[model samples]
Target: MKMIDLTGTTGVIFGVANHRSLAWAIAEQLGQAGARLAFSYQGERLKENVAMLAAKLPGSIIFECDVTDDDAMARGFAEIGTAFGHLDYLVHSVAFARKEDLEGTFRDTSRDGYRLALEISAYSLLPMARLAAP
Candidate 1:
């Protein structure tokens, strides 16, 4: 198949947890397409893994961006903008639910747990879109 020529395009990817992550696969495809990439990991624990994968792609960079924190997301997008000058796209492949919350029926999930799941899984995209917009 002819590779999509993404030369000169720039993008940020969120949720590359490890080499096996679907996000990592997407990043690899984007890299192969010639798009420059920046990866955002949720916490320090994930930083090393993301950095390692990003290093394999020329000109790729990684940043810490906990989606639960607005400040961190803002800073991360700012860093991406500064690094790439512009964004052509963004890939969001992150989602989370507490272990306990996942164990029981949906009705058994606590209010806080439900809120946390939605905040991380769904609501995060809104701020990310707004920040990445500019």
Candidate 2:
């Protein structure tokens, strides 16, 4: 069978919670196609985990990023640029909200909860795109 070929593509993906996550799954296929993939995560623990898992995919890399932190975001993209020079695509499936906001009544959601969700889930895309764009 002929393999899918994306040999020159460099991609950045966010929100890969695990090997089974949508982002990881997409990245895995992209890697199979010979594309280079860079993944972003929010914490130390996740970085360690993704580092191990992403290693199985060809040319895959992990970047530490917390969408809530501007410095981390800037540094993460800058690092990716240093490694790949340019980016061909981005897969962003990130979302965050408090347990209460997601499980309890909408009326009970805190102001901070709403702000945090919007900032991380909705507003972060622009900057991520801007930094990663070729």
Window of ten residues with lowest summed lDDT in model 1: 1-10
Go through the candidates in order and give the clash count of each: 0, 0
Give per-residue CA lDDT, model 2, range 32-54, as digits (tens).
88889888988887887688778
Off by over 4 Å in 1: none
Give the poorly placed runs of model 2, Cα more than 4 Å off.
none
lDDT of 1 by residue, 1-134 (tens): 53799999999999899999999999999999899999998778888999999999999999998899999998998898899999989999988999999996989999999999999989999998998885
**Best-fitting candidate, scored by lDDT:** 1
lDDT, candidate 1, residue 49?
A: 95
RMSD of 1: 1.2
